[model samples]
Target: MDKNIVFLLNFKINKASSSRKRGSRLIQNLDSRLRGNDKRVKVKKRKKFVLLSLVFNYILFVIYRLSYAAKYLIN
Candidate 1:
Protein backbone atom coordinates (compact mmCIF):
# COMPACT_ATOMS: atom_id res chain seq x y z
CA MET A 1 0.00 0.00 0.00
CA ASP A 2 1.61 3.21 -1.20
CA LYS A 3 0.10 6.35 0.31
CA ASN A 4 1.05 9.71 -1.18
CA ILE A 5 0.22 12.27 1.46
CA VAL A 6 0.36 15.94 0.55
CA PHE A 7 0.81 18.64 3.18
CA LEU A 8 -0.32 22.17 2.32
CA LEU A 9 1.06 24.91 4.52
CA ASN A 10 -0.01 28.55 4.11
CA PHE A 11 2.23 31.13 5.72
CA LYS A 12 1.34 34.81 6.06
CA ILE A 13 4.24 37.18 6.60
CA ASN A 14 3.10 40.64 7.71
CA LYS A 15 5.20 43.74 7.24
CA ALA A 16 5.93 46.13 10.15
CA SER A 17 4.12 49.04 8.42
CA SER A 18 1.04 47.05 7.41
CA SER A 19 -2.32 47.21 9.19
CA ARG A 20 -2.94 44.81 12.03
CA LYS A 21 -6.32 43.57 10.98
CA ARG A 22 -7.02 41.79 7.63
CA GLY A 23 -10.66 41.04 8.54
CA SER A 24 -12.78 38.30 6.90
CA ARG A 25 -11.53 38.88 3.36
CA LEU A 26 -8.23 37.12 3.97
CA ILE A 27 -9.95 34.19 5.58
CA GLN A 28 -12.32 33.76 2.64
CA ASN A 29 -9.45 33.72 0.15
CA LEU A 30 -7.56 31.09 2.12
CA ASP A 31 -10.67 28.97 2.47
CA SER A 32 -11.26 28.88 -1.28
CA ARG A 33 -7.67 27.97 -2.03
CA LEU A 34 -7.74 25.16 0.50
CA ARG A 35 -10.93 23.77 -0.98
CA GLY A 36 -9.41 23.71 -4.47
CA ASN A 37 -6.32 21.94 -3.20
CA ASP A 38 -8.43 19.38 -1.42
CA LYS A 39 -10.23 18.50 -4.65
CA ARG A 40 -6.92 18.01 -6.47
CA VAL A 41 -5.65 15.71 -3.78
CA LYS A 42 -8.82 13.66 -3.89
CA VAL A 43 -8.42 13.03 -7.63
CA LYS A 44 -4.82 11.95 -7.25
CA LYS A 45 -5.74 9.58 -4.44
CA ARG A 46 -8.44 7.96 -6.55
CA LYS A 47 -5.98 7.30 -9.36
CA LYS A 48 -3.39 5.84 -7.02
CA PHE A 49 -5.97 3.58 -5.43
CA VAL A 50 -7.08 2.19 -8.78
CA LEU A 51 -3.49 1.47 -9.82
CA LEU A 52 -2.65 -0.20 -6.50
CA SER A 53 -5.66 -2.46 -6.69
CA LEU A 54 -4.73 -3.57 -10.22
CA VAL A 55 -1.23 -4.50 -9.13
CA PHE A 56 -2.55 -6.41 -6.14
CA ASN A 57 -4.93 -8.39 -8.31
CA TYR A 58 -2.14 -9.30 -10.71
CA ILE A 59 0.08 -10.58 -7.90
CA LEU A 60 -2.74 -12.70 -6.54
CA PHE A 61 -3.37 -14.21 -9.94
CA VAL A 62 0.25 -15.15 -10.39
CA ILE A 63 0.40 -16.80 -7.00
CA TYR A 64 -2.77 -18.76 -7.69
CA ARG A 65 -1.38 -20.12 -10.93
CA LEU A 66 1.89 -21.13 -9.34
CA SER A 67 0.14 -22.99 -6.54
CA TYR A 68 -2.11 -24.79 -8.98
CA ALA A 69 0.89 -25.99 -10.95
CA ALA A 70 2.66 -27.17 -7.83
CA LYS A 71 -0.36 -29.20 -6.78
CA TYR A 72 -0.62 -30.79 -10.21
CA LEU A 73 3.04 -31.77 -10.14
CA ILE A 74 2.69 -33.42 -6.74
CA ASN A 75 -0.25 -35.55 -7.88
Candidate 2:
Protein backbone atom coordinates (compact mmCIF):
# COMPACT_ATOMS: atom_id res chain seq x y z
CA MET A 1 0.00 0.00 0.00
CA ASP A 2 2.84 2.39 0.83
CA LYS A 3 4.54 1.69 -2.48
CA ASN A 4 1.31 2.32 -4.33
CA ILE A 5 0.87 5.64 -2.61
CA VAL A 6 4.44 6.67 -3.49
CA PHE A 7 3.91 5.78 -7.13
CA LEU A 8 0.69 7.80 -7.29
CA LEU A 9 2.37 10.83 -5.74
CA ASN A 10 5.22 10.65 -8.24
CA PHE A 11 2.79 10.48 -11.14
CA LYS A 12 0.84 13.48 -9.89
CA ILE A 13 4.01 15.50 -9.46
CA ASN A 14 5.19 14.73 -12.97
CA LYS A 15 1.84 15.70 -14.47
CA ALA A 16 1.80 18.98 -12.58
CA SER A 17 5.30 19.86 -13.73
CA SER A 18 4.44 19.18 -17.35
CA SER A 19 1.33 21.36 -17.13
CA ARG A 20 3.36 24.23 -15.65
CA LYS A 21 5.90 23.94 -18.43
CA ARG A 22 3.14 24.16 -21.05
CA GLY A 23 1.65 27.23 -19.40
CA SER A 24 5.05 28.97 -19.34
CA ARG A 25 5.58 28.18 -23.01
CA LEU A 26 2.22 29.68 -23.90
CA ILE A 27 3.03 32.86 -21.97
CA GLN A 28 6.41 33.20 -23.69
CA ASN A 29 4.81 32.84 -27.12
CA LEU A 30 2.24 35.54 -26.37
CA ASP A 31 4.96 37.88 -25.11
CA SER A 32 7.05 37.44 -28.24
CA ARG A 33 4.04 38.10 -30.49
CA LEU A 34 3.21 41.27 -28.62
CA ARG A 35 6.78 42.48 -28.88
CA GLY A 36 6.81 41.87 -32.61
CA ASN A 37 3.58 43.79 -33.08
CA ASP A 38 4.91 46.69 -31.06
CA LYS A 39 8.04 46.86 -33.18
CA ARG A 40 5.98 46.96 -36.37
CA VAL A 41 3.80 49.77 -35.07
CA LYS A 42 6.85 51.82 -34.12
CA VAL A 43 8.41 51.32 -37.52
CA LYS A 44 5.23 52.38 -39.31
CA LYS A 45 4.92 55.50 -37.19
CA ARG A 46 8.53 56.45 -37.89
CA LYS A 47 8.02 56.07 -41.63
CA LYS A 48 4.90 58.21 -41.54
CA PHE A 49 6.74 60.92 -39.63
CA VAL A 50 9.59 60.90 -42.15
CA LEU A 51 7.19 61.16 -45.10
CA LEU A 52 5.26 64.02 -43.54
CA SER A 53 8.47 65.96 -42.84
CA LEU A 54 9.64 65.48 -46.39
CA VAL A 55 6.34 66.80 -47.77
CA PHE A 56 6.45 69.83 -45.47
CA ASN A 57 9.99 70.63 -46.52
CA TYR A 58 9.07 70.41 -50.19
CA ILE A 59 6.17 72.82 -49.70
CA LEU A 60 8.43 75.31 -47.95
CA PHE A 61 10.99 75.10 -50.74
CA VAL A 62 8.32 75.76 -53.39
CA ILE A 63 6.98 78.75 -51.48
CA TYR A 64 10.45 80.20 -51.19
CA ARG A 65 11.08 79.74 -54.89
CA LEU A 66 7.77 81.41 -55.76
CA SER A 67 8.54 84.43 -53.57
CA TYR A 68 11.94 84.80 -55.17
CA ALA A 69 10.42 84.73 -58.64
CA ALA A 70 7.78 87.30 -57.67
CA LYS A 71 10.49 89.63 -56.32
CA TYR A 72 12.50 89.30 -59.50
CA LEU A 73 9.47 90.06 -61.66
CA ILE A 74 8.54 93.14 -59.59
CA ASN A 75 12.09 94.51 -59.75
Candidate 3:
Protein backbone atom coordinates (compact mmCIF):
# COMPACT_ATOMS: atom_id res chain seq x y z
CA MET A 1 0.00 0.00 0.00
CA ASP A 2 2.79 2.39 0.84
CA LYS A 3 4.49 1.73 -2.50
CA ASN A 4 1.29 2.38 -4.36
CA ILE A 5 0.82 5.69 -2.58
CA VAL A 6 4.36 6.74 -3.44
CA PHE A 7 3.86 5.89 -7.10
CA LEU A 8 0.64 7.86 -7.25
CA LEU A 9 2.23 10.93 -5.68
CA ASN A 10 5.15 10.78 -8.11
CA PHE A 11 2.82 10.57 -11.06
CA LYS A 12 0.84 13.54 -9.91
CA ILE A 13 3.98 15.63 -9.47
CA ASN A 14 5.25 14.81 -12.92
CA LYS A 15 1.93 15.65 -14.54
CA ALA A 16 1.72 18.99 -12.78
CA SER A 17 5.26 19.99 -13.81
CA SER A 18 4.64 19.11 -17.48
CA SER A 19 1.49 21.25 -17.52
CA ARG A 20 3.38 24.15 -15.98
CA LYS A 21 6.09 23.90 -18.65
CA ARG A 22 3.48 23.99 -21.41
CA GLY A 23 1.86 27.04 -19.89
CA SER A 24 5.17 28.89 -19.72
CA ARG A 25 5.95 28.05 -23.35
CA LEU A 26 2.57 29.36 -24.47
CA ILE A 27 3.12 32.61 -22.63
CA GLN A 28 6.54 33.05 -24.19
CA ASN A 29 5.14 32.62 -27.69
CA LEU A 30 2.42 35.17 -27.08
CA ASP A 31 4.87 37.68 -25.68
CA SER A 32 7.14 37.41 -28.72
CA ARG A 33 4.23 37.91 -31.13
CA LEU A 34 3.11 41.04 -29.29
CA ARG A 35 6.61 42.44 -29.28
CA GLY A 36 6.88 41.94 -33.02
CA ASN A 37 3.70 43.91 -33.60
CA ASP A 38 4.80 46.65 -31.24
CA LYS A 39 8.07 47.12 -33.11
CA ARG A 40 6.26 47.53 -36.42
CA VAL A 41 3.92 50.09 -34.94
CA LYS A 42 6.81 52.01 -33.43
CA VAL A 43 8.61 52.19 -36.75
CA LYS A 44 5.52 53.52 -38.52
CA LYS A 45 4.93 56.12 -35.86
CA ARG A 46 8.53 57.26 -36.03
CA LYS A 47 8.27 57.76 -39.78
CA LYS A 48 5.12 59.85 -39.37
CA PHE A 49 6.72 62.02 -36.70
CA VAL A 50 9.76 62.70 -38.91
CA LEU A 51 7.57 63.71 -41.83
CA LEU A 52 5.47 66.05 -39.68
CA SER A 53 8.53 67.72 -38.23
CA LEU A 54 9.93 68.34 -41.68
CA VAL A 55 6.69 70.00 -42.82
CA PHE A 56 6.52 72.12 -39.70
CA ASN A 57 10.09 73.29 -40.15
CA TYR A 58 9.43 74.28 -43.75
CA ILE A 59 6.42 76.35 -42.74
CA LEU A 60 8.40 78.13 -40.05
CA PHE A 61 11.17 78.92 -42.49
CA VAL A 62 8.68 80.36 -45.00
CA ILE A 63 7.12 82.54 -42.30
CA TYR A 64 10.54 83.81 -41.24
CA ARG A 65 11.44 84.71 -44.83
CA LEU A 66 8.17 86.57 -45.29
CA SER A 67 8.73 88.55 -42.09
CA TYR A 68 12.25 89.44 -43.21
CA ALA A 69 10.93 90.70 -46.53
CA ALA A 70 8.33 92.83 -44.79
CA LYS A 71 10.97 94.41 -42.56
CA TYR A 72 13.07 95.28 -45.54
CA LEU A 73 10.17 96.85 -47.29
CA ILE A 74 9.22 98.96 -44.23
CA ASN A 75 12.78 100.19 -43.80
lDDT computed for candidate 3: 0.73
TM-score of each: 0.53, 0.55, 0.53
What local lDDT does model 2 show for residue 23?
57
- The parts of candidate 2 lying over 4 Å away from their true place are 1-29, 32-37
Clashes of each: 0, 0, 0
Which digits, one per residue and each the tens of the lDDT, describe model 2 over residues 35-67? Answer: 566556778999999999999999999999999
**Candidate 3 residue-wise lDDT, 1-75, digit = tens:** 368755755565565566887656555554555456655677899999999999999999999999999999999
Q: What is the lDDT of residue 2 in candidate 2?
A: 62
Full candidate order by lDDT, most accurate first: 2, 3, 1
lDDT (0 to 1) per candidate: 0.63, 0.73, 0.73
- In model 3, which runs have C-alpha deviations exceeding 4 angstroms? 1-37
lDDT of 1 by residue, 1-75 (tens): 112212222233232125436634445555666567655678899999999999999999999999999999999
lDDT of 2 at 43: 88
**lDDT (C-alpha) at residue 57 in model 1:** 100
Q: Please report the TM-score between candidate 2 and the true structure.
A: 0.55
Give, for candidate 3, the lowest lDDT window spanning 10 residues.
26-35
In angstroms, give how far residue 58 of model 1 lies from its true place: 0.6
